[model samples]
Target: MKRFEDKRVLVTGGTRGVGAAIADAFAAEGAAVAVNGRSQQSVDRFLATRWGDFHGIPGAVGPRDACRAVVDAAVAALGGLDVLVANAGVFDELPFEQVTQEDFDRSMTVNLGGVFFCAQAALPALEESKGSIVATASDAGLISYAGAPAYSAAKGGVVSLVRSLAIGFAEVPVRVNCVCPGNVDTDMIREAGEASDDPAAYRAAAASRAPMRRMATPEEVAAAVLYLASDAAGFTTGVALPVDGGGVAGFD
Candidate 1:
């Protein structure tokens, strides 16, 4: 049998990139997945194809109210929840000097606050179902990334959040963990490259910077998320697993 057969899952930011891959992976493993995008239109588009039968829990997830709404909607649709993937986040790569208050807040709210509130909202369901949570953090949270100071701080909060939540939920059966990926080959990365004057050079430099000499695929990140959410990782909690192609290991 598939690992997640008959399980129920909710994936925030399920419209694209690593989020989409993680959603698809859960569905493929026989979970009744709930996909959450910022809007219904984006959710519909994501489910317009392979995820046609999956539930769409569309809503913006940053603050407490919105996260509660998404979790409530997903639980209502799925009857219960076996896993909650807090994968929704923003990537604003700005130098420390260039980052404005708005930019800093955006990263903190969406990247760190969303993960915190989403898990808080989902905790009861997870406890009842003896389920788990997998959040998408960043290797930037672990290592110093000079270009994205605010983003790094936000994700660093996530790394810490996972650890704290794991302990908080230990009285119950809920488990919490996070995956930290670096330089994923997703639209986010592509757009960052294309925004540069030399897109190819930008991509090349990103690839070369990783110790593995290539950016990780979304599917690779998805695999790490799935492992953490599955029963295979039942004993694991408060962990920050890096799926960063050795980027978190250290410089060459």
Candidate 2:
């Protein structure tokens, strides 16, 4: 039998990028997966692919109501919840000097607050099943990144939040963890590069900065999520696993 046989999962931001890959991984492993996106259109497109056992759940994770709605829909559709992947997030570069209050609040609301409320919304079901939560943080959370102070701060909050949740849920014993990926090759990253004067050069520089000499594929990051959500990691909780190709090791 597949590792995730008979499991039910909900992945926020699952319509694209790292979330999409994580959703695919869960489905492939025999889980009934719910894919949440901001729009019904994007969710429908993903569901139309008929990839594994998937249901479309359309909602933005930024709002408290939407977070609860997504979880409620997932539970209704999938019968029960075995794992919650709080993967919805946005990214942008803004130097500390130029960072507006609006930009900072937006980043925190989506990146950190989204994860927090999503997990809270899924808490009852997870407690019932004693399941786990795996959030997508970033290497920026673990260390500093140039030109993305708001983004960095938001992710750093995610790491801390995961730890706190793990402790909070210890009585019920629901595990909470996060994955921190570095320089992933996704549409989000591509868009960032395109915003530069020379997209090609921008992309090249990003790849070169990684000690591994290449950006991580979304699949690679998904693999980490898979492990965290799996029974194989039953003993693991409150850990921030890095999938960053050694980029967080040191200055060198």
Provide the lDDT at 110 for model 1.
90
Give one clash count per candidate, in the order shown.
Answer: 0, 0
Ten residues in sequence with the least summed lDDT for candidate 1: 44-53
Residue 186, candidate 2: Cα error in Å is 0.4
Instruction: For candidate 2, report its TM-score.
Output: 0.97
Candidate 1 versus the native: TM-score? 0.97
Off by over 4 Å in 2: none
Candidate 1 overall Cα lDDT vs. reference?
Answer: 0.90
Task: Put down candidate 1 lDDT per residue, 1-252, tens digits, no spaces.
Answer: 998998999999999999999989988888999999999999888878873349988999998999999999999999999999999988877879989989988889899988999999988889899999999999988985788899899999999999999998876878999999988999998898888889999899989888899999999999999999988898999999998878878779
Q: Candidate 2, clashing residue pairs?
A: none
> Could you list the CA RMSD of all candidates, in the order they appear?
1.1, 1.0
- Listed in order, each prediction's TM-score against the native is 0.97, 0.97
